[model samples]
Target chain A: MENENLIEVNHLTKVFASRGVMSKGQIKAVDDVSFSMPQEKPTILTLAGESGSGKTTIARLILGFIKPTSGKILYQGRDIWKMTKDEWVRYRKEVQAVFQDPYGAFNPLHKVDRVLTIPIRKFKLANSEEEATDLISEALGVVGLKTDEVLGKYPHQLSGGQRQRIMLARAFLLKPKLIVADEPVSMIDASLRASILNVMLDLKSKFSISFLYITHDLSTARYVSDNIIVMYLGSIMEMGPVDKVLVKPLHPYVKLLIDSVPVPDPERRWKNRIELPRIEITSQSLQTRGCKFYPRCSQRMEKCSKERPDLANVEEDRWVACHLYQ
Target chain B: MPDTLLDVRNLIAYYMTPTAPVRAVDNVSFNVTEKEILGIAGESGCGKSTLAYSILRLLKPPGYIRGGEVLFKGSDLLKIEEEELRRIRWKHISYIPQSSMNALNPVMRIEEQIGDAIINHEKISKGELRKRIEDLLVSVGLSPSVAHMYPHELSGGMRQRVVIAMAMALDPELIIADEPTTALDVVVQRGILQLLRDIRSKLKASVIMITHDMAAQAQIVDRLAIMYAGKIVEIGDANDLFNDPLHPYSRALISAIPSISEKKKLKGVPGFPPDLRSPPPGCRFYPRCPHRIPGKCNVDEPRLIEVKNDRLVACHLYR
Candidate 1:
């Protein structure tokens, strides 16, 4: 049966035990998160938040780097964790990942060509050596990189933008249904970020590849993503279409986040200064019951402390987990 | 002009590699006025940090100032003796190095680290030092108890605050913060930038903020300088520069920034930044600039010239 959804994350939760000698408690890195990608439509969904917000944890969970402590992640109607060997291989090939640090992703010793060639050989993407070479050049060309310039060079020889593009090319070669890009353009220079982002946009429209674009930056998130998921302290603060969620944020946390993003225009400088919470929200101090963002939220209420708000649909196709909406 | 706090004239610093001298900061000249925030923005390897280090005479071996005059309070910093420079280092001028948040000593308590910076410069009583440390922590929006805790106990933003507190320990007239908020998150980064702005006003200090983040520069900088391949490509009032940039490199850079308020087609500057060791004879950004005049840009290097009131640009088009 052709599954309607490409990937479905059902009530996903990941708890990491805090190893600090002083505090031996569990950190709920991801808490009761659920979303899905459609198999037919290619869309860029961004998971954006500050550091320690569990955006990367969700990416890791989806990529199967670490097993979720609870909940099911169904890929094409199959449980990813309980997949057979064939299913696992198919899953790995169909789902690709591009990490933040381009330099760190590649083996320093290997030539850059190995990044493309090894994938082709392993996945049996080509019938023969000639076909593999053709495929390599095509993939590189798709990402706007010439084969000769990048093929024989070491990772360090190329600029950060080129290295990142090479990673994109590698992903393109696999013809992945989904690519979990975690901070892909954050390490690259500002001038080079647009090219990489444009390439992601092109891949979506041209090749019809869905992207789970994870980043802390809202500007870029708003640029490429069709949908946006705002996470804070291991829970979804808001999730909806990018235009609706970012423009008219229902949750106070999303509003604060959008406000914090420094607009490039000088005409619209920030008027009010934000007051950060003096007390740090450590895992040990997390109430385990209330809204996770209560400590920092500006519009937090008394009800926020007593009961946790579920990810409730507050608007048309917009979901906000906040007491204000309730 | 608003009482120039620091004036840099024809500053040139190069890293002497075995093969050749990498002209990291070449013919860079700018000034910081009283209580001004001057932002130096460029891609990595554009020598933004080196320019700051050169101003302080902090460059190590393989890196030396070729030619420059750093006039701080009417005195030539480059020609000053080590003894005179040491006295002026923290008292008159201070530096917050790039990623200095992680530079804190994990074992030492925050107070001890802050105290070390103070006693090294001047003598103060233990009681006075303790009180000063508490005051510094509170000023940066941290609690007094933070002084007693180790670096590991504080979050990234809080540690950054502690570093800022240490920089302001002596109440210097100028503070050079290199990528002060690069490692931080958006909300945390806003708070830190605000703290820097507050510190500037409270202490009446001029700041030279070096970062590639143009948005962060827009938020805090009073004047902005765009650097390309070891040279100042554009400099103007932050508002004017953002409103209408002159240099093609500056225009490309400004346009490249993704904005949530406006959705427009973004284009990265084509090609890579030229290697500083063997830069092109003409315009360094010629290869990447969209408005490159083939024969002219490849032959004649453009000099930084005043295009308008307080606006400087280095480009053949402007000339």
Candidate 2:
């Protein structure tokens, strides 16, 4: 995996058994998902889906927050969960996460600077107080923040964009090789959304870092992602180069997602409106017969309801799980 | 006669706080005509929500309309009595809040909640209300059985439809939906937009759809108003707004949306929105405007003047 790819996730399947007394079932959050990221090259890989589509579950598995019931998450040819206590600590220093809420990440009582400096103090990467300050300042600069304005301010004092930038600064201060950003700009103002995304793009070029950006927004995914994976009902529907996947969709789910978005085109309207029921999307009751998307899929076939489709190599650099393409 | 259902003239409303007056809405004016869908686009603190709240008469405490007039169906609502305005609220003008689904009471049954709206606005019995609720659910692509369930039992899209159904209970002349479909997915967003359009055309009611997404607005809105720092800088027909945006702010917002139709780099608008408590000396957008005429735009604020035909632009370049 280390030869060219930075991480290789092979046959990744996550299963969660109900722990509470009332519930008893095996929930397959991510089922047989496989993909790899190249080394020395940083690119955005979008894991797009609606709720219960296993997008967040995949992110959790990659970060080692939850272990996959059956599979291997290879980070530089080493199993992420197989790491020892010391090794796990070292890995934590290399991988950081930017959550959805910027303000929610920190304590209400603490100042913004304290939140930014926590990892530095806990990891003990830099000795002495002065050395830690220098490292913190450097990280803040990378995310394009002013130490003067943000240092003494609390989460309430700073705007949504400022708080988000601080979160990025903390991630950078770890000097992590990869950052798993989950809905970083979803909560911010639309005007400030691009600024947050631009910082992620800037960091990739400046530090040779890789990003596993998890989002539901197709527009932002199109603008930043080099490669993308579309997930639906705990399964990978499609994965390929962003340009090919978006421009020439091989799966029906991906096509519907692309067409559903009103593209600001005054002349064109999607005449073929696919009707979707409210209850059909409830993930808790999603029991697959053949394909997970068969219920609402417009181009669904009779064969789709009887046999589960397998991800096949359709063409160069494109993988699809739809029977139509297979 | 402009055929306008609701007309707002220099609406200057603000929250009269003890520390300082929060100038939420400042001399903003727009119109929503019969069978029209007027979209108000802006960022979070751009007075978009304040304007919507003011229209609904839902403002509480220190918030008060300092000046200006709100003309709805030839009646000056700003000067109306509480009882008279209450009658007009749901029967003539109804508000579909941003999170109107969540705003629904959880304890009560679905039909009963809508029944309250129907009962408050119009004289209707339980049998009539139940039929109206069923018909409302059917119109929004939901099963009539949903009215028997609680809020938690129904899905988010279904809950949103319920809110819309309640808003449509009185067969109001106007429906004000603020970020109605924003919380849902793309597919559901399209469905909800279609539902709003269907309600507007079929019921012959005007719709005021306020949102932040420009692409989403192009789907259904007949006209658009771009607000910034408590001021409407641009207003025009939806097609004109997208095709020939005279204002720099409007152009930046339209360009920011990465759509399938266009492949150009979506250039983000630079600089933060001006602080409303103590705003800048001149133009609110001058600091960020890429085409700002340095001296003129920086020193004096521009007026919302008719630039070309039905298009209105509040920029020195247009003036």
Candidate 3:
């Protein structure tokens, strides 16, 4: 059955083996995570959380770099893990990635052109050197880089912003249906980040490409995303429209994350101080049958520590996982 | 007339390699007042970190302080002898590096590390040293029991607090923090910044914070100095700098920050900063300045001058 969704992740869970400590059980990196992207309209959905929040684990799972312990990832209404060889090849071409460290993404020893050319040749996007050159130039031009300036330079020779743009350009060449950008602009400077972010927006609007923008920075996430999924300790805390999720966050964890951001305006400094956990818990320390955020939640109910809260649709378009909301 | 803790005049530092010399910190001048938190804001490669290293006189080989005066407590740090500089370093002027985990000794306990920094300058008994270490740890919002913990055993935030405790051991008059909260998460960053502010008020110490995060800078800094291509392009009070920026680069920088309050168009400066080895002939920011006056900005550089009350700008548009 061909569902009308672009991507559906149902009960996707990934558990890694514990390291070093014998007492520590398996690390539940991602636990029962589920979401779906629509097929009709392209959307920029952000997965936001702090360091140990399993957001990156979801990205890795979607990219097929690691398989889930149990559950299913349906790509275009088909099981991605069970795809045939030819279907997998098509899936690979349709889904692309842009990573956090642009400097480390490419080999310093090779020329910058190799980043775009190899993908083009492998995908057979163009024939002949001249044809490939024209296509590469067009992709670079879309990202506001001239072929003459970037073609022959090494990765070390280009600035961090330029190198990241080159990565975006390479992804653009694939015309991928989805791009999983993990902390894409975190390493770049704030001044140059706007350009790179705008490039992603341009790609989405101009070419109908969906973006899975993963970031720890809430300000940028609010700026670019149409929808947001707040994750913590390998589970969804809240999911809704960007304004509803960020501006007026339902979950306490989401509120804390938004409040923690040091807004640029000095006039509105944080009025209240928040007490933080003395020690951050690792994934191996997740609770068996309670809210993962129960330990650190400011408004923790007695029931929160006893029974795990299911993600319930509290409002028209907003969903939250908290006993208070329930 | 105000109490100036440190005064830097025409400070120029360069990184010399086989190919060419990178003019990292060129003709930078600023004053840090007593008990004030002055922020040095700029993008990467703008020489803010180099300025921090130059102030400490810790520039390694091939990266030399070319010329300038770093006057701390009415003494020219550049002209001071090695013995005198050593006495002043860590005792009078401490530094918190970007990565606190890397700054600390992984194998050493937090209390012992703090003891090593303090006992070198003061003659204290072992018991008194432990007391002092506990007191310092408590002052930075960390529990006194954390004194015996190793760097690896603590979380990233706790390790940073440990670094802060070490920097504050001698109760230094001035602290230079280069991207102190760069790698930490936002929650941890806010806690760290709050700790720094609390320390400054309690100890009445001056701070020269260097970071590219404008939003984070707005939280604690009293004054801000925006650097571009190794030069201090604008300096003003933090509120004034954000509300009424005089330099085009500073305006673009402040505007580039994404705010969650509203969805405003963020305009990134069109081009990258100039290469320090061979910068532009006139204004270093001319290539990327949207309000550049042709022929004038490209041909003649603007000098930093006092314009409105207490604000300084280096721009042809201002003149």
Give the DockQ (2 decimals) of all models.
0.79, 0.53, 0.71
For DockQ, the strongest prediction is 1
Measured with C-alpha atoms, the lDDT of residue B319 in candidate 1 is 63
lDDT of 2 by residue, A1-326 (tens): 33856677889998877675655777888898899887768877888888778889888998888888888988777789888898788778777899999889988898888886778789886898899889888888887777886898778878888899999999888888888999888888776777788898888888877889898888788877789998987889999988888888889999888888787766675566555583434545564668888888889999999888999899988999989977
DockQ of 1: 0.79
lDDT: worst 10-residue window of model 3 chain A: A275-284
Which residue ranges in model 1 land beyond 4 Å of their true spot? none
For candidate 2, the TM-score is 0.94
lDDT by residue for model 1 (B150-264), tens: 9988899989999999999999999999999997988889899899899787998989899999999998899999999999999999999999999998888998999997678
lDDT string for model 3 (B1-319, tens) is 5699999999999999888899999999999999999999999999999999999998897899999999998999999899989889999999998786677888888888999899889999989998899888877777788887788778888888888888888989999988889888888899989988877888889888899999989998999999999999999999989988889999899999999878898888888888899999889999988898898999998999998888999998876
CAPRI verdict on model 3?
medium
Q: Compared with the true structure, what per-residue lDDT tens digits does model 2 show for residues B145-238?
A: 8888889887787889889988888889998989998779888889888888887778899999999987778888889999988999999998
Q: What is the Å distance of residue A39 in model 3 from its true position?
A: 1.1
In angstroms, the error of model 2 at A104 is 1.2
TM-score of each: 0.98, 0.94, 0.98
Better of 1 and 3 by lDDT: 1
lDDT of each: 0.92, 0.84, 0.89
TM-score for the B chain of model 1: 0.98
